[model samples]
Target: MPRGRPAGVPPIGSYTAVGDSFTEGVGDPGPGGWIGWADRLAALLADRHAEHAPPGSFRYANLAVRGRLLDRIVAEQVPRAVELAPELVTFCAGGNDILRPSGDPDLLAERFEQAVAALRAVVPTVMVCTGFDTRGVPVLGLLRGKIATYNAHIRAVADRYDCPVLDLWSLRAMRDRRAWSEDRLHLSTEGHVRVALRAAQVLGLTPPADPDQPWPPQARPLRSQVRRDNIHWAREHLVPWIGRRLRGESSGDDVLPKRPELVPLELPGAVEA
Candidate 1:
């Protein structure tokens, strides 16, 4: 890769993403499955590669399985990604660890730093992301301070390695409730679209258009309605999450990466299985 700013669009010969559900496209539902920001960005990279490189030159791999912690990502996915040696690598993990009540934010950051360092050591261009604010969340709101602290460490680590950062904390668009799914834990499809565009900008690629436009005001629900919805959400999403935690299970326990190999990205409208 070149040192200075890219002449025009940077050529992404290939891309490999590793992390938890965020990178796995959990919230953003697709016809085949979830297509998160990583896949969106890969499509963009593929378009660029088509213009500058050979047809089908751009390859992509996603080793991210949902519910993975920093150590799990480093232990399981990092080595495989390093072996693939893609031109671009996006690593977004440690969010799940930060959400845990028992984990130490500082220690988690240390582990996150190691993962970033290891990836940077092998991959030419490494990208990382910070956790978003949790003020709007119910039980998770208490961890706002911790999330901020962890984000600071993420920025520091990226600075240390001169890696590109997708600063999710700085994205004010995410503050809107519309940016998240009903569960409030993962991003909505629109949110993933915005993130993908921002990540492309960080990598010096021009997105077709911005997805961060302000959302219009929505009608407020009644207090009773809000309470009922919260209760339902707790029963459906929260309880299951807790049950999994108690049993040491993960949503990705039996899941595999949707795309495990570096292959040519389909066109925007094409479906993935």
Candidate 2:
């Protein structure tokens, strides 16, 4: 069999990711680019390839767009992923959709199921992720219930399809303020790394490192500092997000997928600018 053969292929080779900003690595900006969880996952998978598969056989593509709704993800990215027909596919959607003022959880769940079913029919190893616990996010704490509801639906869907689920809601480590960006909407670089490690474990990769390590203690901001920081965050992130919503625009409006096609995997250090 070929090293990257589909049916009996190892998890390390040929992966495709589809969904929204959460998968796109929004807040975790890097010198190379935005090194989101998906990118980190790719790197981890590539690292493991040396054990079971050819070193250069691992490949990955991320078709996630920031601020995308569930329907748009299915309509646009899923078909492309299907065409690519990777050995593993990871999907995280509905987070952006559920954040809308008129968000409908039940309707979104129905759509989510449809997408999962579609992917499961073709892909051998499909993975779905749950939304994070939002109780720690300032101004977004009230949405925890909503996120929990969506996560429950995601679990049910994953069960029906026999797909591995990266239950982000269950990870207490992610609740730390340090795991998030100032926007409090996306993960920090450490957060993305942790998530990728967890995803690798879920895929039976058993990464060399662990994702559950405790974060170092952070200094509690002063009351005055908290207020000042909140003001700055609102001015920088929240205001622009609200403005985009009002204008019916998205951060990904003119942007293309960071990695559109699957190519031989290259670690950050291995590839030069």
Candidate 3:
């Protein structure tokens, strides 16, 4: 783990994040990777600590790699993260696996399971698994089915581990074609902010105050894409969802109430839910 505040540096809860590109702020542009969800989540956690009058502050390290698969995360990121001994750890992966034409469902499941097991061995961490985005790919025809299978597998793995899972798959914004970047894989700046806010909510972090006015001067694509408003949706919705689960709110496969219909594709490992 990286060094924290001096012994006198005020004890803030520590957080560490690991996974692939989404975790890396692949398309976000800003200091502290603020464009990415992980950074936004960290900020929210820190703000929450501030509101509470304090036992400590919030510290975070993001070690996500671009294009990283679960196997690589297990072999590489986890070891380094364990050193941080974080109080909270969030992971966003499986997009690459689902995108691969030949990726195996069982293999993906096995790798995800191993990653979770390895993390658990290190710390009593709160693990978060983000769902995949199926709308933006050029090869959506080949990748759609696999994405759903991977998400279901992720849910299963979360259940097995008794960890909280944020159902990003059900976020209404993700299904909208206009909500993506030009690459069709990455989120637009606005999308990234939305994702960040949502993840914060999932983690039970307080949202930042809204801007005095509506954001984004205009609906331009590459230039005016990022919107900071309502970015806290996740904090409002997902955070409570996680808290309920932690408080023993309910069990028995708590899938989100409404989800987008799975787009059918002829891919291996694809299964109907």
- Per-candidate TM equals 0.93, 0.92, 0.67
Candidate 1 off by > 4 Å:
1-5, 267-273
> What does candidate 2 score on TM?
0.92
Local accuracy of candidate 2 as per-residue lDDT tens digits, 1-273: 101223454555789999888898888887777878888888877777767876788888999988888888999999899889888899999988878877887789999899888888888878999988887577678788888888999889988988888989877779888888878888888888788878877877656667878888778889999889899999999999889989999888888888889888765752211
Q: What lDDT does the true structure give each of the candidates?
A: 0.84, 0.82, 0.58
Write the residue-wise lDDT of candidate 1 on 1-273 in tens digits. 212226664687989999999999889987778898898888877877788778887899999999988888899999889888898899998988887887788999888888888888879889888888888779989899999998899889988998888888878889887888988899888888889888888888767766567888899899999899999999999999999999988888888887888787764563211
Comparing 2 and 3 on TM-score, the stronger one: 2
The full ranking of all candidates by lDDT, starting with the best, is: 1, 2, 3
Ranked by TM-score from best down, the candidates are 1, 2, 3
User: Candidate 3, after superposition: displacement of residue 172 in Å?
Assistant: 0.8
Model 3, CA-based lDDT: 0.58
